[model samples]
Target: MRQTRRIAETPPPEECDPRVEALVNDLIGRVADKWTMIVLEVLAQRGELRFTQLFRLVRGVSQKMLTQTLRHMERDGMVTRTVHPVVPPRVEYRLTDLGASLGAAFCGVWIWAEDNLTRVEDARARFDDRQT
Candidate 1:
């Protein structure tokens, strides 16, 4: 049995095609949004969740923002929405394989942030002091 280490390197600029670069940049912009990242994290952890459950789990997110974020994720094929028909419609959202992969990829960013938090706070404090 072998354990594999995750690599966080990016391809060199010359190796990236312009169109692909543009699309990747756009996708990064979308997925890097606070709400999107939070939603991805929650779904990755909780498996499947109802809209209301998600709203509750994702603290401080408004119902409208959750709805919008879920729609965008579904549109991007990152999540699947299942509607259960009954007296009251029950809808649940689960991450697609693509979404799970994205969450795994973003884990590195979370790690980086955690590792750099103290440094970042010091830098911010210094900058604020200089501004005063």
Candidate 2:
């Protein structure tokens, strides 16, 4: 009997063609931040939110870190920021069309995780039982 390796459905393009390595690297580099997915999800769900709202929505994120993440996402053309001339100078952040597309991608992954979380927990419990 021979054992066969399970091939990944979406292997890195470079494995098939070297020409795609640069593109893969660029795409990975752009979204390499831990907070990027959360930010996208929040923006997707809320449409537009102020900095303070985001701080509350995403737990454990510092104000400075949130500001920096938003700035980077804005620079990457994934988010847009609007400033109001109000007394306190209100500023709001929202996903651009491009950002919304990325947000949808994140949402898809999030859904997959949520759907499989129970299975994952069960698997972990079984594994731990085996160790005991």
Candidate 3:
């Protein structure tokens, strides 16, 4: 059985290319990771942030992992990394229009979760009860 409703049973929806589908899957997988969402949230709230600032703001994430996430975001054209030539070399990151739009889109998910928290909790409780 299909989990998602299909608008039509025959012809598929528009923009169903395999390459696009694979890219969407890869990007979605990356965004669904714990650190990516938190970093996106922190950057969205705080605007531009330096390496140390991000490390501090996004607590519990190691420096190495943060570096990787930032790199991935940069490669995806979601974030822009600026390097400042200074005594210690300062690098700051800010979200591009794409990243900002993505953040805004995910904000809708947060709103939905907040709106349905009680219903979701009730469902979870009912599921747990059945397991026992």
Off by over 4 Å in 2: 1-34
Question: To one decimal, what is the Cα RMSD in angstroms of model 1 from the true structure?
Answer: 3.8
Return the TM-score for candidate 3, rounded to 2 decimals. Answer: 0.86
lDDT of 2 by residue, 1-132 (tens): 955434475443355666566655754666657787788888888889988899899888999889888988898788999999999989999999998887665565678989999999999999999999
Better of 2 and 3 by TM-score: 3
TM-score list, all predictions: 0.85, 0.72, 0.86
Residue 116 CA error for candidate 2 (Å)? 2.0
- On residues 72-104, what C-alpha lDDT tens digit does candidate 1 reach at each position? 999989999999997699999999999999889
Which regions of candidate 1 deviate over 4 angstroms?
A: 1-18
Give the Cα RMSD of candidate 2.
6.4
Question: Per-model C-alpha lDDT, please?
Answer: 0.91, 0.82, 0.91
Give per-residue CA lDDT, model 3, range 64-114, as digits (tens): 999999999999988999999998999999999999888887787899999
lDDT of 1 at 132: 100
Off by over 4 Å in 3: 1-11
Prediction 2 global C-alpha lDDT: 0.82
